[model samples]
Target chain A: MPPTAALSIRDLKFRYPPGADDAPAESGEGVGGWIVDIPAFDLARGEQALLTAGSGAGKSTLLSLIAGLLDPDPSHGAGTIEVAGTNLLALHGAARDLFRGRSIGMIFQTFNLLHGFSALENVMAALMFSAIPPREHRARALALLERLGIARPNADPDRLSVGQQQRVAVARAVACGPALVLADEPTASLDPENSANAMDLIQSVCRESGAALLCVSHDPSMAERFTRRVGLRELSAAPAAVGG
Target chain B: MAMTDFQIVVRSLTARRFSTVTTIITVAVAVALMLTLLGMKDAARRAFDRGSGNMHLVVSRDASPLVAILNSVFYANPPRAPLSYAQFRQLRDELPVEWAIPTQQGDSFRGLPVTATEPEFFTRLRPDPDREWRFAVGRVFRADFEVVVGAGAARQTGLRVGDQIYVTHGTGTVAALAESAGARVGEGAAIAHIHKEFPFTIVGILEPTGGPHDRVLFVNLHSSWIMHAHDRRLASDPSVKTTGAADVTDADRLITAVLLRLLTRPGQDVTAVEPVVFDQLRRAGGFTVAKPAQEIQRLFAIVGGIHQIFVGMAGVVLLSSGIAIMLALHNSMEQRRRQIAVLRVLGASRGRVFGLMVTESAVIGLLGALAGVGVAVVGQQVVASIMRGQLGLVIEPTVVPAILLGVVAATVALAAVAGLVPGVMAYRTSVLRSLKPLG
Candidate 1:
C-alpha cells in the first residue's frame, strides 16, 4: 500500500508579514517577523506520528499543511504531494475546502470551541460545515461525544476541566468519522494525571475512527505512545525546515 | 437551504430573542404609520365626495362658490338678489336641464328653520339618483297645515306624527326654539300643509342621508304662499283654510324659484349641451350657471391633496426606517465576518455565504414592515371614535394589500443593502485563518 500516505507535502516557502520593509515609520508591528521553509513531509493512514522541535520551528505548520490549512504549498520547490489518493497540489480554493472537509479532522493545541455554544453545541456546529445531512447531525455528534467519553452533552468547556475540553475538541474532530486526525500539542496544558487521560482519549478515538494520527509536540515524553517519532531536523534541515 | 429555510430562520431568530424582536418591531412601526395614513385618506375622500353630490348648475350672471353651493345647490340661504319669480319661469321654459327644484332659505323652526321652501323643492335635488329618499314614519306633507319631519329633525326635537307646532317668525334666534312651549316647534312638531292656518299631522320621517337634509322640515308650496297670503286671508276667514293636498288646479302658480327636469341617458352620456343651455338660461334668468361634476372634481382635488400630504409624511417615516435598517446591517458586518469566513470554509459557496447574511437582513426588514402595518390598523381604529364624532371624518381601516406590497418590497430592498456589506466582508477574509485559533 506504500504505507498509505494520508498527507504528502512538497518543498514550500512563505514570507509571514507580506514583506520585510513594507512597515511604515511607526505604527509599530515591529518592522518584520520571520519566514518558513519546508522540504518534504508525509503521514501514513492509521499510523501515529509525532513532531518535536523548538518553539520557533513551525511544528504547527506541518499539521496545518497535512490538514490542508495553508494553501497547497505554492513554491513547488519540493515535489508532488498526495493525500488519501487525492493530489493536494492540483486543487483550487473551493475544491480544497471540500477535500479538507471530507478527508481531514483537525485538533488545535488550544481548544477553540465557540464561546456561544455548549459542548454538545460546539460538536454539532462542526458537523454543520460538512456535507452531512442536517437531520443526521445530532446522532452523529452525540455518538462521537459518547465514544470520547463526554458524560454530559450540555456542559460548556468553561465549566469543564482542561482535560475534558481536549476530549470535546477531539470528539469534534472525529465527529464525522474522517480518514485522518491531526492534533497539535493535545496534552500540553494537562498535569500528569490529566495528560494521560487526554492522550488515551484522543489516540483511542482516532484509532477507533480508522484515521491516521499526526500529533505535533515539542515534548519528547509524549512520543512513547506513538508508533513513530521524527524530529523537525530529521524531516529535513534544522531552522530552515518548518512544520507549521 | 431548502423549504426548511423558514424553520431555520425562525429557530435562528428565537435563538437570538431580543435582537430579532426589536428589528421586527421597528419594521412593523413603519408599516403601521403608512397604513394609518392611507386609511384616513380614504375616509376623507368619502366625506368630501358625499358633501358635493351632483347639483351641477348655479344660475347667475356671476355667483361666488359659497353662494353657488349654499343657495343654488344646498338651498340653505336665499339668493342675495332674488330675480322675480317671472324670470325663474322664463329660464325654465328655455333651458335643457335634468331637473331644477327651486329653493328658499333664511327662516327657522324657532331657531332652526332657516330653510323655508316647498317639499318637492328637494325631490328633484337627488344626491344619488338611484337611491331617492322618502319619509320613514307618519306621512309626507299632504295639506297646507301638515309638516313632514326629517330624521335629524325627529331625533333632535323628539317630535312625532299628529303633533302641532308653529314656526317662529325670525332668523338666527339665540334661545332654544323648544324653550318657548306655546308657539315653538317642540316634541310634537308635525308636517303642516302650506297655505293653511290650521295644524295638521306629521306623517312620515326621511332616511338619514348623512347630509343637511337630516335637519329639514317639509311643507307644501301652498304653505309659504298662504303665509304670504295671510294679509289677504284675514277677513276671508279668521281660521286659515286647510287644503289637505295641493290644489292640483294651481300647478302653474307662482314660486320663488323654478323647477325643471330633462331626461338623463345612461353610460357615456355627455350632456354638454345642458351646460351651454344652462348658461344661456342663467343669462336669460338674470343669473349664472355652474356644473356639479366640475365642482365635485374641484372638491376631490382638495381631498386628494390632503391625502397626499399624509402619505408623504408616512413616506418620510418609511425612508428613515429604511436608513435605520441599513445602518444596523452595516454595523453588524465586522462582528459577523468570522461567521461568514467559517461558513465559506464549511463548503458554503461564495453566493451561499453571501445569501445567508442578505437573507437575515431581509427577514428582519420584511418582518418589521409587516408589523408596522398591523400597528397602524389598530391605531386608526382607536382614534376612529374621535374622528367620526368631532369632525364627521370617517376613518375606516381598509385592508389595502398594495400598501403592504410597498412595505415588503421597500423593506426587503433596504435589508438587502444591509446584507450586502457583511457579505462583502466575508468574501474578503482568508478561510484558512478563520479556522485558526485567534492567537
Candidate 2:
C-alpha cells in the first residue's frame, strides 16, 4: 500500500560451494561457507538505510548479491531479491550485469577511479551504458563535477587529492540517475573532516537524484547518520559476530 | 563510473607506454618487411619489362642467349667472338631491316665500357617510345676523338663536357696482353700501360634512362681502331689505321654485336612475321640469333622464385608479431583483473569486456601496420637510389595502394585473433574473487 520498495529481499540464503557440512567438497558439501541468510529486508523508494557489519560478517558478499555480481547458490540457498521491480535472483550473467549498470550506482571504499581518466571522463564513462544520449554525456558529467565542488573536472584521477577523488567517485556513481545507490565503506580511508564531508556530499547527492541509499560499513559510528540501520550479524542469521 | 569500451582501451594501452610502443614497433617492422619485399618484386619486374625495347634482336657469334644479352645490353661478362663485319654488311644489304647499329667494345675509360658506334645509335634508340634520350648538358659526339657520357657514367666519374679522357685498349681481360705487347724490349718484361695518342673529349651527357644504356661512354667506331693500333702487337700488323668514320674497309672494321629492327610492311603484323625471320636467321648459320626479351623472361622466373621465398619469410615475421600481441595482452590480463571486475559492476557484460580486449589488439595492429607502411616508403627511396647508382636498374619507390590496404587489413585481422586468448581470459574473470584482497 505504501510506496513500492526500491529493494526487497525475503527467504534469502546463500552458501559458497553449496550443501550441508556432511558431504565432501568435490560433492559441494563442507566446502560451503555460510555467507548470507536474511529472512526479510526492504528499502522503500527514496528512503536511505545504513548496513553495518564486522570484517567477516559478509557485508561485501551481500552487496555483491544485490549488485548481481554473485548469484544466490541454487541448491543450498533459496531467496528472492528485487530492486526497482526487477527480480535480481531471476536474472543471470549478462542480463543481471546490464540491469545493474542500468539501475544501480555503486561507490566502493577505496575511491576506485580509473587512473588514466580525468575526473569528468570517469563520470561520462558510467553514463556510457545508461539511456543518456551520447551528445549530453559531456555536459552532464561537467555539471555533476561542478556540483560536487571539483575544480578540475578534466584533471587525471591521481592528480586530485583523496577528498577530490572520492567526490569524483560519488559523481560517477550517480551519473546514470540510477534508482539505488550502494556505497561500500565509502569513507574507510578518510580523516574525520573528509569523512564527514564525503558522507554529507553522498547523502545530499543521492537525495537530490531521488535514489535510495543502502550504504555498507564496518564502522558502527556511521549508523547515527542514517534514519534506518541494520547489522550484518542480524541479517546474516549468525549467532556469533565475525571480526571485520 | 562506466567508461566506454574505447576509452578503456586507450587508457589501458597508454598506461603501459613502453609495452605498447614495443608492440607497435614489432608490428611496424613486420609490415615494412612485407611491403619492401613486395615493392622490390614489382620494381624488378618493371625494370626488366622495359630493359631493351628498341633492340629486340641481338645478332652475334654463337653463344648462350643469356650471355649475349648480358654482354650486349648490360656490358657484363666477357666478350664473345666478334660478329664479322661481313655478317653486318650482309644483314644490312639483304634483310628487311628498319635499322642496324653495331656496338664495338673491349675498351674502357675508368672501368666504364666504351662503345664505338655511329651517331644514329643515340638518335634511333628509344627504350620507351614516349621517352627519348636528350642531352642533359651538351650535344652527342661529333668528331672521331669526341665521346658522349651516359647519365650514370657522368655522375660516377664527375666528368663534364670538354674533359679530355685517354682510352686504354682492352681494359678487362686483354688489358695485360695489350700492355705486355706495348712494352719496349728494353723495359725488362714489365707490361707498359698504353694510352691512345689522342685523348677523347667529353662532348655531351645523356639524361637518365633507368637502364644499362645509362652506364656507357659512346664514341665513333673509328676511335676504337685508332686505340687498338696503339698496342705494339697490333702496330706491326699494318691493318690498324686511323681511318675516318666513313672510310673503313671490311678487313679493318670489327664489331661485337648487331642490334636489329626488322621493317614491318604495310598491313603486316611485325609480331607475326618475327618468328619466320628468326627461323631464317637461325637456318642461315652465319649469325647466332637471340631475343633479349625472352632471355629477360627466364631471368624474371628466377627472380620471381627468390621473391616468393623472401615473402614467405616476411609472413613468418608477421605471424610472430601477432603472437607477440597475444602474449602482451595475456600477460597483462592478471593485472587488469580488478579493472575488469570494476567494469562489470558498472554494467559491462562479459561480452563487452571480451570485445574491449580484442579491440585493443586491433588498435595496436592498425597502428603498427600504418607505421610499417611509412617505413617501407622511406626505405624504398634509399634502396632505389642505390640500385640506380650501382646497378643502373631503376626501381620505383611506389607500391600498389590496393595491395597496401590489403596488408593493413590482414595485420588488423591477425591482431584481433591475437587478442582472443586475452579476451576470453577477461570474460571468464570472477568479479567477486578479483575484488578480494590477495593473500
Candidate 3:
C-alpha cells in the first residue's frame, strides 16, 4: 500500500471564461479549452518537490488552487485537494481561509513581509490565526527569527537586505508549523548564491518542522535540490490527466 | 500576548501625522461652532429669566411690549414717553401694591446705563421673592451724590468705592458723539454738561447676577431729579438752591417706568393680580403694562430664527468633516491594497478587515470631538465678553454634559458611516490577484 500523502490532487480540471475582462488567458491543456487539468499528484509526508513551468502555463493558478485562494469552477472542474487529511476543495469561503491559515503556509517571490512590522513581528503576525497560545507567540517568533540567522529581529523589514528579508519570509511561512509549505519562486529576485542559500534554508526549516514543501521555480539550479521534479506540460496532458 | 488591532490603527495614524491632524482640526472647528451656538441660546434665555425677577408687571407709556420691557427692565432701547411720578403714586395707592420702584432712564455713565430710583429700589426689589440683592463690598448709597455700581460696571471701569464718575444726562453714546462732533444747542442735551458739575462717588459694588442689572449704575432718584432741575435753574437764574437732596422738590417729575410687585394673602393666587393691575393701568389712559417673561420669549423667537440658520451652517461643516475622514481612509486604502491582501493571506477574515477600517475612523472622530468641546468652551467665553461689552447683554457659558455626550455619540456614528463604503470595498478585494508572483 502507498504511504499517506501530506498533499494530494486528483482528477482536477479548470477553465477560464473566454475573453472575461479580469481573466488571464491560460493556454495549455485544451480539454474543451480547460485552463488546468491534472490527475494523481501526491507529496509524501515531509517530502520536497519542485514544479517548473514557463509563463502562462498555469503555475501560479495551480498554487492558488492548492492554497484554496481560488474556487474551482463546478461545471468543468472535478477534483479534491487534500492537505494533511483535510479536503481543501470541500471547504468554502471563510472556513477554507481558516483551514489554509492553520494547515498551509505560502512563500512568495517578493518576500512579502509587511513593511510596517519588524522581522519578529512579521512572524508573530502569522501565529495570530494559528492554534498557538497567545503567551507563546512572542517567544516562538523570537526563537524562529534566531534560528533563521536574522541578526536583527527587531529591525524593520524595509531596512533588511534582500537575503535577510527572504529568510524572514521563510520564518513567517513555517511559524505556524503548517502541514504543507508552498513556495512560488521565492528566490526569483535573489542572486545565484543567495538563491541557493534561500532554498536550503526553506528546505531545512520544513524538514525540521516535518512539513511537506512544494516549490515552483524557473531556475534550473533549483531542480537538483528537490527530491522530485515534475513538468507543467506533464501535469496538463490530456485524457488520463483527468481520470479518463 | 498578541498585539491588538487598535495598536496597529494607532501606529498607522501616527505614521501619517499630517492627515490625522487636519481631520482633527476640521472636526474641532465644526464642534466648537455647534457648542457655541447652543450655549448662546441657553445663556440668553437664562439672562432674561434672571432679570425678570419677582416683579411680574411693568408700567410705561403706551407702546410695543418689547419696547416697554427693553426700556424699563434692561435700560436699553430708545426711551418711551414718560409716565408722571404722580401717576405712579396714584397706582401705588389704588392697586394692591406690595412695593413699587420708580426708575428714570435716558442717562448713562461710561457706556453703562445710569438708573435713578429711591433707596427702596435695592431694599425692596428681589430677583425672586425669597432672595434680595447681595453686595460684594461696601454699602448702598446714603448721601445724594453717592452711587452703587453693578459688578459688570465696576469691572469695565475698574472703579472702587472712592472713585467718582459723572452721569451723562441724555444717553452716553449720543452725548459723547455730540460732544465729539462739537455741536449741541438743545436744552436736554445741555443736561449732560450740567450733571458734570456734580460727580457721584461709587459707594458700593453689587455681586454678579448674570442679569441686565449687572451692567447698570444705580443712583438716588432725588439726585437725578436735582441734576435735571439744576439744568433749568442754571439756565434761568445764575443762583439756585443746591444745598441738599430736598432742594430737588417734585413739580413735574416724570419717570420712564415703574416695576410692580403686588401684595397677596398667603393662599391668594398671585397670577390673578396681573390682570387687575393691567386693567388699572389701562383705565389710567397714558400708561400701559408689559409682562417681561412674555416679551422676552418673543425676543427669543426672533433670535431663535437666527440661531437655526447658524445651526444649519454648523451642521454642514460637521458633515464636511465626516467627508474628510472618508476621503482620508479611502486614499490610504489605495496605498494599502497589498498590505490588506497580506493580512488575508495570514488568516484575517473579510469581516476583520472591515472592522479595522471602521475603528480607524471612529478613533479619529472621538479624538476630534474631545478637542472640539474644549475649543467651544473657550470660544463661548470670548462671545460672552463681546456681548457684555457691546450689547450690555450678560451671558455666561456653562457646560451642559448631556449636550457634549450627544456630540460624541453623533461624531462616532458619523465616522462609522463615513468609513462604511471604503470598508466594504476592502472586504471585497480579491486576494488571488494581489498575492500572485511575477509568474
CAPRI grade of model 2: acceptable
Q: List the candidates ranked by lDDT, beginning with the highest.
A: 3, 2, 1
Candidate 1 lDDT, B1-439, residue by residue in tens: 2113343345445645676777677767777877777776665555435544444455543365444554444444445444444556556665666665655443346344434445555465654434566567765566665777766667767778877766543334322433354333422212122222545456666776555556666666556545545523433576855433343223323343443444456542355566567656655555555555565567668768877887888788776776666566566555555555544433445666566667777888888876776787788887665554433333455756876677678777877776677656655655445544411
Q: All candidates' TM-scores?
A: 0.69, 0.88, 0.91
Q: All models, DockQ values?
A: 0.20, 0.38, 0.49
Model 2 Cα lDDT, one tens digit per residue, B307-382: 8999999999999999999998888887788788878888889999999999999999999999999999988888
lDDT per residue as tens, model 3, A1-244: 1246788887777766666433554445455676667767778778888988787788777887888877667886568889987889998877887788888889999987876778888888888888899899999999999989998999998898999999999999999999999999888899999999999899999999999998999899988897688777777774344211
Candidate 1: how many backbone clashes? 54
For residues A104-182, what per-residue lDDT tens digits would candidate 1 score against the true structure?
7777666666554567776776676577888888877777778777788778678987777888888777866677777
DockQ head-to-head 2 vs 3, winner: 3
Ranked by lDDT, the better of candidates 1 and 3 is: 3
**What is the Å distance of residue B176 in model 2 from its true position?**
14
Best by TM-score: 3
* Candidate 1: CAPRI quality band: incorrect
Models ranked on DockQ:
3, 2, 1
Candidate 3, pairs of clashing residues: none
